[model samples]
Target: MQFQKKEQYRRQEIWELVKGKEEKISRNFQQSGYERIDDNLFAFVNIGYQGHAGQAFPNQYDTDTERLLWYGKKETHSKQPLMKRLIDGAITFYCFARWNDDPNFTFLGTGKLVNYRDNFTEVFNKDGTQTFCLELEFDLGDNSIHPAWINNFDASFEAEPPDTKEGKEKYVRHKTRERDPAVVKAKKDEFQKEHGRVFCEACGFDFKKTYGARGDAFIECHHNVPLHSILGETQTKTSDLTLLCSNCHRMVHRKKDWLTLPQLKSLMERN
Candidate 1:
């Protein structure tokens, strides 16, 4: 499946993104199964209709770490079971999160089922009948989308190789900002309006142009002004935000002395 626009997925629209054209079966998290345990980590449960009313016991799901164990739905009597689709290698899953009521679901990127097991667990039905149902375990695949908002996820501004003096100074100079989603959208929209498309301001790399549908309108937001340089509590203007491709963003922070936008442009020209 091609990557859908992240902005297009907002509020209740997530259901459409997850189910696609498929009819809505159940509204229960286990049925429409998605767990937003943290900002970076998400799990999709493929449990079928069985044990729908039972307690969801998430084994090995420790919030402090990146590891997650999703319990698959109990096997159903259907011809092609949902749990069966997970076993097949062709099916791909993407995780999403709407952290702290941010309005937009942060696309946590694609994941693959790492491991599975057959287990019998106690499940209590609505009528109070207790039954042990068969369940499968699913582990998240890729670690590409590690956002700082996640509880234990590494922050981008953290000190690099803290043993050296330069590393310690870089850490002290690093600062983080509380950016507003609305402002970030406005900045992207405003740039797209004038330039006809959003691209890396430094390298002119466009995600949509390169990856087609999957990468449409996807660009990392960078705070232009150094966070540590701000004197007091100040509002961030849209002009203060710059758009960059992931590669350029990493290059900007490649060294202890962060590269300014102009400096990056200069290096690009020299090359």
Candidate 2:
């Protein structure tokens, strides 16, 4: 069950998708914040909200969407069966975030674990109970997360448009302008006008040279501006794209911070 980015979902809707009218599972439907439907996790998160144990978990996502901190639920411990699912094998972590008191949650996409601190969080409850929770840092994947997270973080829905800041800054991600065919053609047109054909900007790998005329005008477009560096405020332009061969594009996104074009070239120089 995959949740699309920026799409708002209700508790019942999620229950329907994960378990189809299964009574026992639906009974515990809204009970667990971290629910496991098979190997993957669905995090129903409310930042700065108090759990039933009166212990409010300090779930936070920085403006850059760099360090996504998820607090374990009440009585959750390190090395537990469920907790192990986070870093165990190749599992996807999905997040649904909402404004305070909002009915629906917007999907934040799959996350990649960067760091985990077992029992590093302390929460004081209103009932005089102290809970030591675990904190896990899972930076959401750029492609699936940037759009949804950009719309809701720090947003207040009571008396506003829910975009937080009342400015004219527009970002394309959900509909994903970068992947649009028109955008790709525009970039190719501009690049061919200047450089004659598409090639890797970082390593200068010409696909056509490597594979005859069959690879003509063939190159991948790396979004170039790292999502973490975007801070959810800048508009991506055609110039923001950098044409690259497949290998160089993957290398650029190998790390969380994402390597710049110059940094990739420096590595090539060393090699």
Candidate 3:
């Protein structure tokens, strides 16, 4: 496959690109199932079904807009360095899937590590069922519409990595955001005192107006300057913050050139 990880392609186009170009690979590439180049691994699977072969391992790879659940071999448990490599963040995993027998696939993009489980699901075979030991889940960036339903199974971890010391430390160091609740509340109170009620400063969206009791006084605050971008300890003022709806707050930081409140409101009005 002349595959660029970022581009979408139909199965026929993939076959056309690889055909006769490389004698080592099958002319019909996606049929080959898996490919690897150094530390990068890509797998193309037929969604919602399993291959009927004389095998004991699982092949039920399921994906949605938000997640991609992959299975690995149990026979290689303790023997496989893959378990450690995945958690060590050494390998980049990519996956593409087609619903049932479709001729095309959706590029699932480079998967970010979520966590893996042991003995997660059972794959039935001719003789009996095989309980898969290595089950990996990944976080795909956004969520919304799904193209098709192919075994939309509930994803869960039966057992996490036996060595979670490094994972735990890494999560705390990187994923946890440093935000002061006192400052956020102070800004909210300031807005309510002046405007008579706290609502999105940019869009003037009243959460309670839409969600009723569930969204009462539920307005999100976005830093005019991102906290991460600031170096060292600095004082935060209410003027440095803007009250926004959850949607607007996310949109503000979605791009590298962070949109100002006026910019967002202008775009909203134009559309």
User: RMSD in angstroms, all models?
Assistant: 17.5, 13.2, 13.7
Q: Which stretches of candidate 2 lie over 4 Å from their true place?
A: 21-25, 49-56, 143-271
Q: Which window of ten consecutive residues has the lowest lDDT sum in model 2?
A: 148-157
lDDT of 2 by residue, 143-176 (tens): 4332222211112112232322222233422111
Instruction: Residues 172-229, candidate 3: write the lDDT tens digits.
Output: 3123223455556667788888988768888889988899988776786666775434
lDDT of 2: 0.62
**lDDT digits (tens) for residues 1-271 of candidate 1:** 3445233345345555445547563455333444332121234332222334444344443333433454433442111333333333223445543323334555534544443444444555578765444343233334433332111112322323222221111212122223245556667789999999889999999989999988777787776654434544566677887788877776765443568899999998999
TM-score for each prediction? 0.38, 0.48, 0.41
Alpha carbon lDDT of each predicted model? 0.48, 0.62, 0.55
Q: Candidate order by lDDT, highest to lowest?
A: 2, 3, 1
Superposition TM-score, candidate 1 onto the true structure = 0.38
Give the count of colliding residue pairs in each prediction. Answer: 1, 0, 1
Ranking by TM-score: 2, 3, 1
Full-model lDDT, candidate 1: 0.48
Better of 1 and 2 by TM-score: 2
Question: How much is the lDDT of residue 17 in candidate 1?
Answer: 46
Model 1 spans with C-alpha error above 4 angstroms: 1-177, 228-231
